[model samples]
Target: MTAVIEVQNLTKRYKDKHALDNVSLSIEGNAIYGLLGRNGAGKTTLMSILTAQNFESAGTVKVFGEHPYENSHVLSRICFVRESQKYPDDATPRHAFKAASLFFKNWDQEFAEQLINDFQLPMKQTIKKLSRGQLSAVGVIIGLASRAEITFFDEPYLGLDAVARQIFYDRLLDDYAEFPRTIILSSHLIDEVSNLIEHVIVIDNGEILMNEDTDAVRDRAVTVVGDKAKVDAWVADREVLHREALGRVVSVTVLGALSDDERAEVTASGLDLAPVSLQQLIVRLTQKAGAETSSDNQEVR
Candidate 1:
């Protein structure tokens, strides 16, 4: 696979704290990657360093096979959209779209205007006068309409309502099908984007934890249910994420999937299997002990 962006031995420090520690990652071309983690997990730091918006304390960053620092050729092909994106005083959404058109060679003005109308954004109002949701819409339109070779969206839906967020997701997928490119979306809503991303990169405590295909990560954890005695025996010596018993029945979540033989063994033991939610699995991986007793809470899509 041709890596569109590569980072080696990357590290970033803020005083005594390490924002990123000895990180090494490669992003392949033309695929949607979900960048996920809890708050303060260094997702923003990593993206900023990759896009040349921030400097890394140590490590090498390359985009399109060349160093991205001060490299106009590489920078021009990338669009970084975050909630904190800024505009000059008196500049409105119109000015933002105009600036984007001049930068992205593949900028789609029609698409931008359509999105503006869809979001009901005011084109004439100064950015300072717009609401938080309106500000988010401006960033969304620029990110989508820019059509950069690689687009990084770092939690750009902060103030958007459920409907507007869904519109962004639907529009993104539609446009992406026709104009494929690298899109890295960082979202706190894991289940919401579960099926949208082809791969997942999880960061926690300023370090990379899991980087694999969306399906592969799903297979890494599983839940087994059956009689408490049988279930306890079956899960012997295995890592258990959660456990609960109702009357004579017990449900337990374990760290690995059963093999073919193990699957047959489960049948023989009268055990039932239920798929683990991706969000739950990741929550278990990233949260502190006893911090979250369950992951059944659903997110607004």
Candidate 2:
């Protein structure tokens, strides 16, 4: 299948920093992709470039088989919901939805109305007067309702509480199931959206660290928590991602999965086997290249 998005030798630089290095990636269409990274890790820069909201210092970008810049057809097929989406001072959610409907080719008026009611967004209230969560609801509504071929959501649910966040997730998944489109989400809420994302793209310190299936990334590490000595003995020969300790009980996040014999040995040694946290592993991977996980764990190179 043709890639929905492609970046070749991409680099974005500021006066004194490289927000994105020589990154190259291809995104297959019609799948939910998690663009994982911390703030200042180039997630926004990459998205903005893809959506033509920002100019790239160098390299090439193609969306839907063509460069997106100044291309109305490509631009109209993409929707980017930013954390700080701008609006007219006196405009309401109704106005915003109206504008979106005019712009997006596949705008679903009925779907937009359904989302507005589900989110309880005030149609008459000015967007400037809405609460943070309400504002986020407005963005989420447009994102879901627009039904663009390639949608990029850059932390669009900032101030929403757990319940509201779940609503967004559920509605997004439901809509995606019926009408599949490429959805790229950049969020710090890793585990929460883990289940929603089938593909994972990790960026760290201005470079692509990992881009693979979520299941494959999860299989890259395992966490073992138990007696310190046993944990250390088991992990000493493996690369350690992170470690934490509470008195004598130590939890070590190792870089690879245990073999059958290793798992048996862990159980035999009274060491508890546990799932590794994707967040912790990503956090460690994003740290300075040579930096290890602190004194709690030994970094076995």
Candidate 3:
């Protein structure tokens, strides 16, 4: 697969803070990628730079083999749907869709109309008067219907309810099957989008923590549940991410893949091995990273 977006030692600084710290990664074309991280972790910063909405303080960024800044050709092929996207005070959902149709050459008016009906959005009502969820629906509709070569959805559906969000996910997947394009989605609802994303990129404190296929990430950790003493001994030499104890029982999540023989040995030892979900693994990894950072700060003090 060819890389459509590439970064080399990219860094974005805000005053004394490093919004992005020497980050380097490549995004392949025609795949769904989850740009995931906690708040203030640089997910939005990276997306903004890629979409040419913000400038990088240092290093290089390329979208479709060219710098995105002031590059109309590259910019036109990309669509960015942000949660805080603003509109004209008098603009309505209908007006927004019409403008998007003209901007994105691949925009599908029929699909946009379908989404508007699915969300029960009022076409004539001014965007300023719409409810929070309705406003989000507007962005969701534009993002899905635009069908740009690369679409960045930065938590644009936060205001949507569960059912409405499900509709967005379903429609996105269905459309993607027919028209495959690169999608980079950033959201706090990791579990909800886990299945939809083909790859995962995790950032922490302006650094890239993990970037890999979703399946590979899932196997990066496993939980073992058994008697407290047995589980403790079993994981003593392993890198443990998290641990929980209840009476005589213990559950320890360790980072590493078990071999076939090791798996049998674990089962033979009467311990139950459980697969760690993507959300669980990411949470543990970020927590561990945060703790290490704190320790380093304390040492400097």
Best by TM-score: 3
**Of 2 and 3, the candidate ranking higher by TM-score:** 3
Clashes of each: 0, 0, 0
Ranked by TM-score, top first: 3, 2, 1
Which candidate should be chosen as best, given lDDT against the real structure? 3
Once model 1 is optimally superposed onto the true structure by TM-score, how far is the C-alpha of residue 235 displaced, in angstroms?
A: 1.0
- Score residue 167 of candidate 2 by CA lDDT: 90
Per-residue alpha-carbon lDDT of model 1 for 1-301, expressed as tens digits? 7999999999999999999989999999999999999888899999999898889999898899998889999999999999998789989989999999998999999999899999999999999899999999999999999999999999988789989999999999999999999999998799988989999999887788789999888888778898988999989999888877899999888888778898888888889988888888888777633243243323322
Off by over 4 Å in 1: 244-249, 288-301
At residue 14, candidate 1 shows an lDDT of 97
Residues 1-301 of candidate 2: C-alpha lDDT, one tens digit per residue: 6699999999999998899999999999899999998887899999999999888899999998889989998999999998799999989888898999999989999998888888888899999999999999999999999999999999989788898999999999999999999999999899899999999999876789889999888877888899888788888888877788999999988787668998898899998888767787788777634363353356543
Ranking by lDDT: 3, 1, 2
Backbone clash total, candidate 3: 0
lDDT measured at residue 121 in model 1 versus the true structure, 0 to 100: 99
Q: Which stretches of candidate 2 lie over 4 Å from their true place?
A: 288-301
Per-candidate Cα RMSD to the true structure, in Å, reads 5.8, 3.4, 0.9
Q: Model 3, 115-193: lDDT tens per residue?
A: 9999999999999999999999999999999999999999999999999999999999999999999999998799999
